[model samples]
Target: MPNSDNPSFQTEKASERLQRHADEISVRLTERGAVPNFPEPDDRTLRSFSLGEVAEILGVSGSYLRQLSIDGLGTTPETGTAGRRSYTLRQINELRAYLARTRRKEALKFCPRRREGEKLQIISVGGSASTTTSLYLAQGLALQGYRVLAIDLDPDGSLSKMFGYDYPGICFPDRYVSMYGALRYDDDRSSMSSVIRRTHFHGLDLVPGNCELEIFERESTKRFHSEDLRIADASIKMVSALKEVEANYDVVVIRCGGGIFLTAGAYGAATGVLRTVRPEWPEIMSMRISLSFLSHFVSLMEEAGMSVNHHFTKYLVTRHNPRDFSQQEAVAFLRKSLGHGLLTATVWESDAIRDAEVKKRSLYELVAGAVGRSAYEQAMETLNSTNAEVMDIIYEVWGRPPMYVMRASRIAGKASS
Candidate 1:
C-alpha cells in the first residue's frame, strides 16, 4: 500500500521461494552428514535368518533342514558359535529351488513362483499405511521365494527410503532415472527396466520416484485441458510400461500417491488393489471418499470402453490397538460393512515397528533381539499373519491351494499315520 512499484514491496515468486527452501534444506542435510549424490550401494544389508526361522519360512522341520545341510544339499548355511546355523536370503531361495525340484508333489509349496500360465500379479496399494504395507508385502513375498518389484509412485519417495534409496540425498538428476522417466509423454521417455534398482532384500527390486515425478501431474493437466485423446486413454502409459518388464517379475507392488494421472494409471494396470486403513472414524470416512472416487473412476473407464476389472480388491486393517475398545468397535464395524473384502488379519500397532522405522529399517531387516524379543515377535506375528492372508488371496486367484492349509493337513495326516 505504501509503494506498489517498489522492488521491496514485490513478493517472491512461489517457484523461486520453493527452490530457495530446497537449497537451504540440502545445505542443512549436508551439514548433518547426509552426502549429496551419495552412492550407498552397501549401506543397507539384510540380516541372516536362524535355522528355526528358515525352517518356518520354508514350511519344513528344522531337523529336515539340518539333515540337508549335513548331507551337503542346496546352499550350505553359515554355522555360528554353539553349532547354530543361519541362512542368507539368497541361500534360502536356493533351498527353495532345490526342494521344488526334488519334491515334485509339493513343488508349488516349495517355490511359489509364477509359472508359465500364471499372469504377473500387479498390486496397487494405497490409503493409510500404504507405504509400510507395500514395503512389508514386497519383502515378505521375496522371503517366500517370489521375484518382486516395488514401484514408488509418490513424489515424496517415502517407499524408496524404506528400501534404502533416499532419492533426495542420493539421487543425481542426470545419472538416475525414476518411474516418471518411463511414464513421461515426451520422446525422452525411457523403459521401466532401465529404472529398476536392486535393493538389499534378495529377489526384490525397486523403481524409485523423485521430485521430477511431480512434473507429470503438470504435464497431464495441460494435456487434459487441451482435450488430448491420449490423456483420456486409461491403458496407455503405466500398463504399457509395466508390460515391458512383466516377464522378469512374479509380482509388482505399486505404492500409489495422490496424483490423479499416476493413480489412475496404477488403477488401470493393477491386477489387485490393497486399501490399507486404520481402525478409526476419520480414516474410515476418508476411505469412504476414496472408494467413491474409485467407483466413479471405474465407471468413466468403462464408458471409455476400457474394462477396469481387478482380480481382487481387499482392505487391510493396520495400526490397530486390540485392547482399545473404540478401535475394536471400529474394526468390528469395518468387518461387518466389508465382509470377505476385509482381510482376516490385522497389523497391530507396535513400538517395535515404530522403533525400526525410526532407524529407517523394516522389521525383516532386523535380527530377532535387535529390538527386544517380545516386541519383535509380536510385530512379526501380526505382519506375517497379514502378509500370509494376502498370499492366500494370490494363491486362490492362481487356482492353487493355500500353503498353510495344505501344510496343516499334511501334519494332521502324518499324526494320524
Candidate 2:
C-alpha cells in the first residue's frame, strides 16, 4: 500500500505485522497444514534470521526494511557479503532509534493544546503574485485538526481572498491585517479565541485581508527612519504578537505577498523573519512556478538578497501537472543541481482547488461536490502519515506550515523512475 511517492507511507507497514506475529504462525500452520520456518530465538545465538529475523529483533518486518532500502537508508544486501540477507544487532538498534525519532515528528503535525488563559495564535502568509510552498503544509496541518488562524500578509490579499473575503480594491485593509491594527481595535479579544473567523470547515479559521494592507510596508519603512531598509524588526514585532496569540491557539500560519522574501528593492517581511531565525528552526519555502524558472528565480532572489542556505532551505514544486512527467524530471534535475534544497509532495495541479478558492470554499468543504476530488485524493496519497517516513522528519523540523497558499496552479507528475 505504501508508494515511494508518498514519503510517510514509506515502511511502518509492518506495525501490524509485529502484533500479528504470535497468531500468524498458528494461522499459517492451520491454513497450510505445516509447521512454519519462522526463526524463533532470543538475542544470544540469533546471529542470522533472514529479513524476518531482523524484523523480529526490531519488531518490524522485511517489508519495512524494504521500504528503507528503497529510500537508500540502513543495511542492505549490499551491506553484507555475497549478497546474502544480513542485519546486525547494532544496525537493528540504530534503525529502531531512527524510526522513533521520525515518529515524534509526525505527532506535532497538529497544534499544541493551550493553557486555560492562553489565546490561540493564528498567523498566515501567502500572496497572489508569488506563491510560497508553506501553504500546502498549512492546509495539510489544518486538515490534521489544528486550530489555525492564518493572516493574509500579502498585499494582493489572496489568503483572505481564498476565504471569499473581497479585497477592498480601492483602499488597503491595513488595520485588518496588521499587528498594530489588531492590537488597536482588538478589545475583549477574549483569550484570543475569537481571533479566528471560521471558514466552512471546523478547525480552520482566518482573519481576512484587504488591499489597504499595502500601506504597512511603506509605513514600516517610514517608521524605521531609514531609506534603504529591511523589515527584520517588524517581523520580530509580528512574532511577539503571535507569541501572545499562541497562548490561545496552538500555532499560526502567516501568508506572505510574494515568494519567500516579501518584496524587492528595500525592506521585505520575509527578510525580517529569516533574519531572526535560530539555527534550530527550519522553514519550508514552496514555490509555484515553471522548473525552467527555478534557476532564474534563485538568481533573482540572490540578487535581491534572498539566497538560500542549503543546510536549512527547501524548495517545493507547486501548480504542477501530475500527468506531465517532464515536471518530475525537472524537479529531480533541480535537486541534483542544487544539491540539498529540493523537497516534494505528490499534489497535482487541479482546477477544482482554484474553483473552490474562487467560491470561497475549502477542498474538504467543496471536494464532495467538486471536480478535482480524485486528483486531490491522489495528492493526499503522495504525502506521508504522521506515524512514519520523511513527512514526519519535515513536520518535526518545520513545526508549523508556512503562511500562504497558492491558488489555481497546475501540477505535473514525475516521470518514470
lDDT, residue 406, model 2: 15
lDDT of each: 0.85, 0.42
Candidate 2 lDDT, tens digit per residue, 1-417? Answer: 545685545454666545456466656665785642211111222133356545533434568777887787754433566544655434544454566566665332222333354434332222222222334445544443455566655656566555555445634121133332542213522222333455543345665545445555556556546654333444434444555556444445565554222232112212211111111112112233323343454455455455433213333444556556666566566557555444434334556556655655444343333556565555434332210222333333445443111110111122111
- Per-residue alpha-carbon lDDT of candidate 1 for residues 1-417, written as tens digits (9 for 90 to 100): 455675734686757766777777777777797754435543767899999889888989999999999999988999999999999999999999999999999899889988889999999999999999999999999998999999998888889888777767333443345777788777878778878989998899999877767878888878877866443353468888989999999999999998887888788889999999999999999999999997777676677777777999999999999999999999999999999999888999999998988888899999767788888877887888788888888998888877754443444355346
RMSD of 2: 23.9
Alpha-carbon runs more than 4 Å astray in model 2: 1-136, 170-196, 224-230, 259-312, 322-325, 382-395, 398-417
| Candidate 2 similarity to native, TM-score | 0.48
Worst 10 residues of 2 by lDDT: 272-281
RMSD of each: 5.6, 23.9
Candidate 1 ranges with C-alpha deviation above 4 Å: 1-42, 169-176, 229-235, 405-417
